[model samples]
Target: MPGCNNNSRLSAEEVQELKQICRYVRKMIINTVADAGCGHTGGSLSEVEILVGLYFRIMNIDPHNPSWQERDRFVLSKGHASPGYYSVLANRGYFYEGKLADFNAIDSMLQGHPCMVKTPGVDMSTGSLGQGLSAGIGMCLGRDKRGLDFKVYVLMGDGELQEGQIWEAAMYAGFHKLSGLIGIVDYNKVQLAGTVVETLDLEPLADKWKAFGWKVLECDGHDIGEVVDTIQKAKRMSESGPVVVIAKTIKGKGVSFMEGKFQWHAKAPSESERKLALEEIDSCVE
Candidate 1:
């Protein structure tokens, strides 16, 4: 809430710009994933709007000085979604856009999962599911110790919530009253193997978080305006402990063939598939 309370809503032009930016990020994801020949496609596509909303409009970060003392911290709990994370960081000027071409290469900075030591603007090195919230809590505590008001935002996958460590971290954050911390769950329904319902249902998800003393918020994950608005409300809740936004999104968002399918969860598009995906994303630009 440190830098989020004032002018939180986006103007019409800003909303359009954010949408275009997200589209571009999606394009980057498609290209990078296909070119790399191995990457998580569905989850990365699903989280485009959430990542764009945060990096471009929500979080107070300095791309040039990624390690600035006062910068807000972000933890990508669903680290397999590194394509989306890396694309957003590149578009945000954290690194040169050309570097994206080397994603997932033998010795590239943009590896399969996000690494703070390897990539700029990545606050936490996360690949294992459910550990990001714990890391985010630690970040908040460190900022508190330093008397810094910077907030911490953690992005997670709905399937990752099946991990017990996630629940432990949630309880810890809630009990400690980490008001400056926010958790976002990309509820895209599908996971690596199959749908979350078939794998392990987390029904009544909002209620579960509320039971843990977190302020639960819900929004359409792909809608930048709604996501930003929900984040604004989370920022406005004064000292009400930690907040979590359950964002409903579609896996493989922008591509007709991949949307809602689990096969794209970690497979790269073929040449034809990549062309089709790019065409669909280009249609969304205006």
Candidate 2:
């Protein structure tokens, strides 16, 4: 986390600013996804607070020096959530915010999935479900072997837990006691096809992680304060092993009609619908 103020907590003003960033990022996601004509919308919208909490508040890193050796690494295992990821990186000054609308354009730097080689701030290229955690574990191990100090955070989708590779990586991290690796599951419960319960129930999910020998934390994913605080706790938690925070979220948060609806998972908004979604988001400002 080179050149970052590694503060353990946010002051009142900082918290308010972080909340504002989350709201703005939500609008950016709508605009970016709408401009793309088609993109993942529901999960992107749902993950707003968690990403904002990390980028704007918790993680330490220099946007200007994205390749800094000490920079914290992030892997979006649930890579379909690119709309949200791109919006954050753009707004954080990793690249031109205007160009975000060019997402998925042929040969554009911003494409359907994150590309570490193409994107300035992208730590790892990821889109394949269930693979990012394994990559993150390797990063943690790399840091240890190189005697470098930095954390690796992996954000995953709840439905992604069904991937065997995820468990395999979890088991490896647990056995090796990679304390610098943190896994965050966006437990929104809804996927492109249906609810997680109807699709693949991950009941006793936290316990499963515990069984894997990782520390477990759960919080309201949409609550900026809670998300930030929980992450800070994970950072300071005893170095017993890797930590996983199961963040409970809503698939389509903020947009009224789209909230919790699977149909909006990859649905692009019509011009009118985009405007309406923006207006709805504006009304929720507190």
Candidate 3:
């Protein structure tokens, strides 16, 4: 609400506007991690546009009433990326901007991973790799049972797809035709240990989802316009089936040294590195 307007489709001007906001989110993410001295960097950076696209321009959410029943829900299955998550929420006015300074500190509400009980905008407390999609399925099914129509959006790391539970949930969602649920894979291709190909290949990824009965979509995760269009198309498919947007992204997207580097998966930038990263982000907007 603070940065972007809600829309199913965006004009060229709106897309550029969202891109600038996304760059800001990326800057905020690294700064938050640097201030805390520990946080996921690469994955958080890669998914900034995806998160910003959803929170700023797509989802029907209220910053003032985070518990509003009609509000769409979002689950960051890759929960270690709390720096990005917290920064986006703060920027969206769900909480005070100053709280990000306390991230990961002693007894801080903003933990290393998301805790729904403690965090104002977090819908589900998540950290375990393969559980978030299953939880999203449960949310969708429960909403259906209650006769509610709010959608549930879930973001997962490509590495996390190796978990069998994800496929299980996929199968279940497909069978039930839970079209109100949308899944986003941050297919940055690089994960904690190494490349996703070396770690666990999700290639033929869209085909796999198709086999599971999902209406598969793809996009450049960092491209705000394409991402928004894909989400809008997915939302328009309630009569079809569950949708999974395989968003291909570069890990550590905006910053030069960090981009595509697996070592930055969970490493915070040092003081000098932080300064350099911020400069890179600043130049992107300029």
Candidate 4:
């Protein structure tokens, strides 16, 4: 059993710092998509705060030693949006910022999907939909059986919920009483093809989780304060099976033209569009 005695909790100042990092991460996503000529900019932007809250405030990670036994685990099930995840990882000292320029480049560590073998901070190589929760459940169960108290956090796209496997994993987590596991659904309402509601609705999503015997909480994914608070609440409620935090976010949240539009899901920004995105993100900075 791995000792969970490490201090993973963040102070109020650290929360503020994480919020700032999220803003930079959003900018990095916009720029990376613009430079790469192809990427999931919308969904990536929508999950910035969630990633930030986890990496900086909630998860017990050591950038120096990513595979530390006592560290909490995070899996990005929506792996196409690796730009955002990579940005956060880099900002947290997993790698250098210069590495971001090689994103999606041939033979680069930054592939379109997260590759645990290639990236240093990535815990699991996830790209296929509906699999991350299962992996998270496995980690949670492993930790439990080992008498470890570290938590496992999994982030899923809303569209991914349409897959039957997601529900199965949810049920399994609840049935096993994997209280140390936490799943966050990025409910951006849009998928690659269209709005999640128009494609395959997962409405009354929170209720569905509750029905599975898991504690469910909802928050604004873009709001750093709310996201942090919701995660804290989930951590404290771990005694009652697993917990799911449904975060309502806007696809392409920071960019004006891209926000709320499904077109930006996997669209690369054109040269002019890149300039516009940079301008928009620059304005958001203090």
TM-scores, each model vs. reference: 0.96, 0.97, 0.96, 0.93
**Top model by lDDT, which number?**
1
Quantify all predictions' global Cα lDDT against the true fold: 0.90, 0.89, 0.88, 0.86
lDDT-wise, the better of 2 and 3 is 2
Residue lDDT tens for model 3, 56-136: 888888888888777889999999888889888998889998898899987888988999989899999998999999999
lDDT: worst 10-residue window of model 3: 1-10
- Candidate 2 regions with alpha-carbon error over 4 angstroms: none
Enumerate residue pairs that collide in model 4.
none
Q: Which residue pairs come into collision in candidate 2?
A: 1-70
lDDT of 1 by residue, 1-286 (tens): 1332333578899889989999999999999989899899999999998998888877888788888889889999999999999999999999999998999897789989998999999999999898999999999888889898778899999999999999999999888778788999999999889999999999999999989889999999988999998876886662568999999999999998999999999999999999988998898655
Q: Measured by C-alpha RMSD in angstroms, how accurate is candidate 3? A: 1.8
Q: After superposition, how far is residue 209 of candidate 4 from its true place, in Å?
A: 0.6
TM-score of 4: 0.93
Instruction: Give a tens-digit lDDT track for model 2, residues 101-169.
Output: 789999999988999999988999998899999999989888889999888889999989999999999
Candidate 3 lDDT (Cα, whole model)?
Answer: 0.88
The lDDT, on a scale of 0 to 1, for candidate 1 is: 0.90
Off by over 4 Å in 3: 1-5
Clashes of each: 0, 1, 0, 0
lDDT of 4 by residue, 1-286 (tens): 3222223455667666766787789878877877888888998999999998887767777888887887888999998889899999998889998898889999999999999999998999999999999999888878878888788889999999998999999988888787888899999999988888889888788889988989999999987878888887887787677999999999998889999898988998998988888778767853
**Candidate 2: minimum summed lDDT over ten consecutive residues — where?**
1-10
